[model samples]
Target chain A: MRLIITTMAIIVAIWLIPFVLSDESGLKFGWPYSVFFTLATLFGGFLFYLLRMPPMGPFTSSRRAIGSVVLVFLVSIGIITLLANVSPQFAFEGAATAGATAEERGKAVFNDPKVGCFLCHTVQGAGGTRGPDLTHIATVAANRKPGMSAQDYLKESLENPGAYVVPSFDNIMPPVAKALSPEAFSDLMTYLKALK
Target chain B: MPPDVPLINDRLVLWVVSELHLLFAAFVLGSPIFIVISEILGVRTRDARFERLARETMRIVAISYSLTALFGAAMTFVLVARYQTLSNFIFQRFYPIFGLYATFIVVETILMYAYLYSWDALERRKSLHISIGVALNVVGTLVMFLMNGVGSFMLTPPSSPDRARLWELVNNATWTGLNLHRFIANIAFGGFMVALFAAFMYLTSRKEEDSAFYDWMGYIGNFIGVAALIALPVAGYIYTKEIFAYNATISTLLMADKLAWFFVIQGTMVGLLFLGAGYYMWLSIQRIKGGPRFRTYFRGVFWVALIGLIIWLVPQNFLPSLTTKPAGPIGEVAIPEKAIFLGLMPAKGLAVSAIILVTAFLYLLYRQAIATGTMTWGRIDTKAQLTLTFLPAMAVYTMTFMGAVRESARGEWHIFQFMADKSAESYLTPLGYAATVSGLITVIFFLLVSGIFWLGFKVGH
Candidate 1:
């Protein structure tokens, strides 16, 4: 059982990591189901491994704990049924509320159709993990640079995502001001100021 | 062609298309529930006979799944054809969630192949396989939640949403209620379907013991059906509450005078079905020599289910319109109060009747399970029992993670689209409707499926 789970999990992890990373979404099939399939395949491929080993508990029948079986069955069925009937709007609201926050709200400004600079930079643990972490730039710079304020440092980072590449990170931040109208640049700057 | 004929044709086309999508979703959504229940039943009673029940349910779902996928494909086309504006917005606004769905689609396809072939592999690790099935059902459910996030975003667009941060997506607010609602609905849908299948088998079987088998299975199915039916009201309330929380105006659209009446009618008919199922289970129990000897127990269930139905079916209110509007900046919208929620439920006077109805259904199930003699999975052949267990579990966990990913990443859609100057409407809203209409279609189509299954199996009777 351990082998089956381990082998299958590894294979699934390989697929999942890439599927999630870099975010190039190809319309793929169900991953959870595929993981079991992988486990099943490996189980078949390694059938000799099990047969050769001593059996556990005399290879007991697949019977298991059954108390509350009926109740569980009914509950499961009822839950699925309710889900099937309601509108999509309801589902989103429930999931959203469970995970909402202020940092997220401030971060959302980057994804705002109007001023979306946070998309490239890290702010308050939100946005692309691609950029340098900017969660406490003010405090850090106040300590590190001795005299430079947080606002000046952040401004330099935004107009130029590359100016000071944090050690070991890529120096690939494009100069966004070149892409945006002066107004857009200002709006993004204003949104970022509110974040501090 | 006459002008109205085209309009009528349009309605018919929409209905047919809708049925196809929903029917497919039903099978996709319903399969794992059937599998899990069967697995649970087989393991507990030391009876593999329950395994066969699970297989039959899956096979039926498999047949429908093909059609479901077909209609799913069609629904995508329908979006482009019928609801282009909405479709455009969905793609634009909900690109992140959609992207995740796209990735999972590949996973689902891979899993389907494994499901088709894993019988051999599972035979080797039968218990593990079963666990995987449990997990698969979870994944199936997670997929729905992720889809729901994208779908729900349409009707209730998040306020001042950060379209890019995945975390913001997590905070969308509607995902939990929608997920819970869908989860419950699938269970009910699956239970009804299994019962429907068993009923077909009983109606047509030639073997003397076949009646016994079908009767027992149907009885169990009926219990699930009735229980699920009872749970529907509470589920519906949660759903309405979520909608009210999101936007009272949309809730009003959903609960317009005529639509409310439609729901009342729907509730009444389903209530009648519950009573019918309970009655049938009661009769099936009579076939057993040592059935529960309590007529009052049976009578209680009937009257209670009836009363519950009548009470629930009562127009949205009984007292005068004492329900006042909520005072606030959002005051144009009627705030649904806690008192109003109470008033909407069946009157307390009928609570006893509802209890009896639920009790009767439970009694019928208890008696039937006792008589079946097949509740023990251990009694069935080990080799046969090993097939198809646990594949869905992998699906469940991964899909859940995906949903978690989607849930977490959902905020990123806003973050991405805002920078891109794209409205979430370009992707979120239309795709959601397409999914919605498709889900409804899947339901209608599956009912048609039950009818077909009935006809095919009935001939042998």
Candidate 2:
């Protein structure tokens, strides 16, 4: 009973001290202090828990050691879970609010799941890398075939991705002509043109 | 790339959790192979010690098998929650295989339980028990091969008009090499764990007879480990060669980009592994009475490993723009230009092969010394005994480091040519930071493994 109370008190104290210390005018406060405090508390709790547990030597420190390990393990994993749960919002906001210009709308469309452009294509090196990087796709399209303009090349690619498979790449691209509206497709071309 | 969701550092989570999963999985897969071998040895030779050893080993295997399942479940959850992009891609294409993988897991668990529990019950029916062990190993190996197929397909995916084709996805260029490499590595890992168990028993045993038995057991376990260790690098070479053939650009980034230094660190760790194993073998020579007579040959073995260490660690080249300077005629000279050639793949490959061969040969000598009755048993130095314990730790460390290298090779892509890693955490960590993180994870792994061994011991008691 004493151990549980003491551990809880220590954990509560650990949680409170950082906020209290940061409130003081004299000290420069940042996330580092909280991170440090959290880590120290975890370790302090782990050590105390292990110290209090019955000994199982050669093996030593009993099952509590595994508890400590799991505590650390879960905390690291929890942080990842938190981050993964949060990031998609930022990515969505950044894309959705890209603006009303042709190039901006094209980017929004490119990133849009409905259009599914970024599912296989890379744009300015930020999207899926399954398809060819479109960082300079505009230039490549111009000289890709004799007598073909860049606009026509881009049009062909959007409608028929299998027409020309890049060397070392599999022709796994599904045709996306029906997935995008004609205006969105034109905007996507503008975005590709500005990529260079 | 983003939905209206909170962000997480998926890469770190995946790396750490996947490594934990791999460690347990390796032990689970590796343990069965040797358990079957030990069972056969016992049945054939009618030795009680081997039978007890085999039974005791199964205890560890059973516990590890449970942990592997637990971690596998956790890893699946992590994939679903955190690595949705890659997870979705895999599941979308290989849904049937995922079902098959789960089925294998269930069947494997049943077989493993039966194998573990039936040892004493079917003692008189030795062949029947042995067959159960073989069935268990087959299921376990199938699990490993199936999992490796998924991982390797990501590294060298096959392109097709139909993206969801099971056969094409699973049979990618790198799959064969990965299966072979992982198969050998699993044996090496299992051997080390058995040796570790024996070492612990040797150290803790009160009776001289028990100690002697464990000492011999440790020797046999370590010998199996080293033999499999010898084949591991060759299998690794095949895997890397396939990756290079799949795409030169991806290969260049893995070998020479920001990740290059991690390979250097991997080489250093491998050198330490060779040296540690060789040194342990050299020390084990003390158990043999006229083991001293082979002292000259032991020294040769030591020198071969030391030289191999030096050659393997030589950097292939300086940073791209940094010019190499000629050595001075006097003191404090730079490493000669000619010396850098030794660091290249072919040269380092030869050096490592020579080291393994020499160490293996020295093992033969140790066996020969024991056979002629020139070697005394149960006479290892305390420190030398500690090195035997250290051998397994080194093996685990080498596996973790090399595993890190293999994943880092994927570099900014979840599936090399098929999918991109566009998560916020897709950036590659610097080599030093990554190595430190890996080292920390290795320590955690050792602690966890030690805990498992302890639990196994307690259960047996």
Candidate 3:
């Protein structure tokens, strides 16, 4: 009983630190994050206590063995719950609230989490290196395929990605058309055309 | 273009069948290596128990070999029918080598059956019988090595595929590392399966002698499993380093961008394996007369493993996937700068190395206990047997999880940079979805393996 009280006291004390600091310093460490850290610290304390126990024998009864498994299972579920709760939720506010202009909205669409364009393609200095950098894509798009205009090429690349494989790149571009609203698709095309 | 199969998730079907194939394949290929060793020991020690163990395990290999072939044939059909375009490309590139692969498989099957059927006939000529066992291992390993060439070629194909010779294509950048990793893993996996079999038999045996023999067998099986497991980290490190050397972009995609969450789960499962192995060792030690004397050493080892596990579970980002933002107000706040260092490679690498070291140390302690004290077989607590059972499940889950991570690391490509998966199923599935599929595969495999164990017992009776 005393050990339980002491553990609770320590957890409460640790949890208060983040809460108080965030309130005073204008930081945004939310309640869920604080709860996660507190639980993690509590788990650490539990491990420390377990380590300090006297040398033990093998579990002599089926009940004891099952109880141990139950304890481990509960702890595992707790960890999974905490992780899931702390994970970021998906949102499209970034694209939805951007300026109404085609290029501006297109840029927003490109960076939107729902669209996930930046996960593979780089523009300027940001995004991933898996696909080609689109920093100068506007200039190169026109010359990529003869008799095809820059807008036409970019449109084809988005709709039918396997139509023309780039010389040095794999044909890995997904059909972004499926992921976009028609308006968002138009905006994304304008954004790509204006990359120069 | 890849052909589409109606009314089914083609990739998921292929994933399940291929994973099942690999599981059975690992057992067949891995068990023979140790079976030969057991046979040799039986001859040298003049111990009939060793001889019985060798024969019993050979029976299991015989049963599992057919499952391996069945799954292999199913996977082949799926590849030919659903993935015709990619299949054609590979077939055209390595037509002659596929013939060699087929020939080796046929030869391996013939040799395996002969070794099993000739156990008694060559009992008088123990040397010749042992020779056949060794010959069987050689052919099984060659079969795996040749297939490794084709698998690794997909990940790290030659730079100039149009002009590269056949040998160069086979000996790609990641081929040797993968071969070494899989070789060690096969031994470890085989050992766990053996332990699982022993645990089941021990639990169900009505006679004291059977229980005692199974108890000893479980120890040996777990010993082999943990021994190989201790060496796996180094092999895995070499494989990862080779991948980085082959392509930095692909490495980034795995470690940082898309597949990082999958790796985090893998680390957790691996930590469970070490914990399970350590706990079983601790329990086994208690059954020895003088084992309690080593309690101090066990405590220290336990602390090392616990700390290592905590460090390994830390993720670089709190986000579950790349595209999402942190929920609620936390979304506006970045992960604190100070906490970032703990999640990175330097700390994680140190933690993994420490975990491996502690496991090895625990095994050494178990060995010392056995050397100094008398082992009371069939006298271990039920919990120890349960732990023995748990190790195999963890091992299977780890295998399936890691396999998923490796295949998913290819992302939208059918063959890395060489060929694209332009099928309807080209995109990367979410980590949660892939994990669910992997879990399903693990459960199905356990059920089938249990059936195989039952059949082997019936046949022996």
Q: Score the docking of each candidate (DockQ).
A: 0.01, 0.03, 0.10
lDDT of 3 at A120: 83
Show the colliding residue pairs in model 3. Answer: none
Q: TM-score of each candidate?
A: 0.52, 0.69, 0.79
Place model 2 in a CAPRI quality band.
Answer: incorrect
Better of 2 and 3 by DockQ: 3
Question: How do the residues A1-196 of candidate 1 rate in per-residue lDDT, one tens digit apiece?
Answer: 6766766676767467545643223222233324423433453335424222431221122123111222333332333334224311211211121244444443433444223344445665433455666566556644544576666766677677666777767887767666566655555555555543
Ranking by DockQ: 3, 2, 1
Model 3 residue A115 distance off true place after TM-score fit, in angstroms: 17
Show the lowest summed lDDT stretch of 10 residues, model 3 chain B.
B325-334
Ranked by DockQ, the better of candidates 1 and 3 is 3
Give the alpha carbon lDDT tens digit for every residue of B90-145 in model 2.
88788888889889889998998998888779978989999988998898888888
Give the lDDT of residue A117 in candidate 2. 67
**Which candidate tops TM-score?**
3
- What TM-score would chain B receive for each of the candidates shown? 0.70, 0.92, 0.96
Candidate with maximal lDDT: 3
DockQ of 2: 0.03
Please report, in order, the local distance difference test score of every candidate based on alpha carbons. 0.47, 0.68, 0.77
Q: What local lDDT score does residue B248 receive in model 3, on the 0 to 100 scale?
A: 65
Q: What is the lDDT of residue A138 in candidate 1?
A: 53
